[model samples]
Target: MNGDDELSLLSWMYGHDHDDPVPAPRLGQGYVELSGGPLDGSLLDVTSWTEDEIATGAVLMTVLGQTGPDGQARYAARPGDPGRWDWSGDAV
Candidate 1:
């Protein structure tokens, strides 16, 4: 694999959860809209989203090790290396 591929895998295996809080905004049918601030506190402009979109994003993030407690996967930072990753919770 290329360097980018390796780095992508590494990030997937050792990425942190999205640090920003999800803003609880009013949403219309099939779409949630953010009035102020970036969506998910991200700098990018994310104007709208749907429940299915959110669920799919969460699932993908979990698979990529960027999930928090709410996500399906559980993770903890390594002792010495903050970037390293491992599962932290009860088995099964």
Candidate 2:
């Protein structure tokens, strides 16, 4: 992906609107980026009323979490008894 695409993805991840549609992802430039995800870039919606969804808000479905260092987990909301979130990156 190019720089612009990455920035757009970042904006989507941060769940904020940008005057330029796909705004740059700076800590305080105008967006609040969340930390964690599927890593596949599914672009989970951790916040409500995303700029793109302002017309039609969305409901939370799958969830993702990033723990210390390499620790990471995913809680997918799927059919019948979703699997528990597991993180193998935690150090003992």
Candidate 3:
């Protein structure tokens, strides 16, 4: 009927019972961060992406300063940094 009880009920409804506190989510687990260029400091969700797909990298769209109206900017993942993607220049 109180906070803990309510949380437990919610957890049960979600199909998981956690006696221990759930650890905070980290980057690359459910999402990856974008670094450098136009898409700097952005987070891309990878929850549904396969390992191969992620490793091959992604072409993310952005409307940052470089990309004007109706424009598209693309970024790619750099080597040795799976947790982050770097800008690869603007797209047509």
List runs of model 1 lying over 4 Å from the truth: 1-5, 9-71, 90-92
Tens digits of per-residue lDDT for model 1, 1-92: 89843443333111323553432222331221111211221121123545344433321123322344434443333355432333443222
Give the runs in model 3 whose Cα sits over 4 Å from its true position: 1-29
- What TM-score should be assigned to candidate 1? 0.25
Q: Select the stronger candidate by TM-score from 1 and 3.
A: 3
Kindly list the per-residue Cα lDDT of model 2 for residues 11-86, writing each as its tens digit: 4442334355544443433222222343333333333434444322222222333344444443233233221112
Superposition TM-score, candidate 3 onto the true structure = 0.57
CA lDDT of every candidate: 0.30, 0.35, 0.56
Ranking of all predicted structures according to lDDT, beginning with the best and ending with the worst:
3, 2, 1
Clash pairs detected, candidate 2: none
> What's the candidate order when arranged by decreasing TM-score?
3, 1, 2
TM-score of each: 0.25, 0.19, 0.57
**lDDT of each residue in 1-92, candidate 3, tens digit only:** 79843433332111113353643333345655666666565556677889989887765544454657545556566787777677777767
**TM-score winner between candidates 2 and 3:** 3
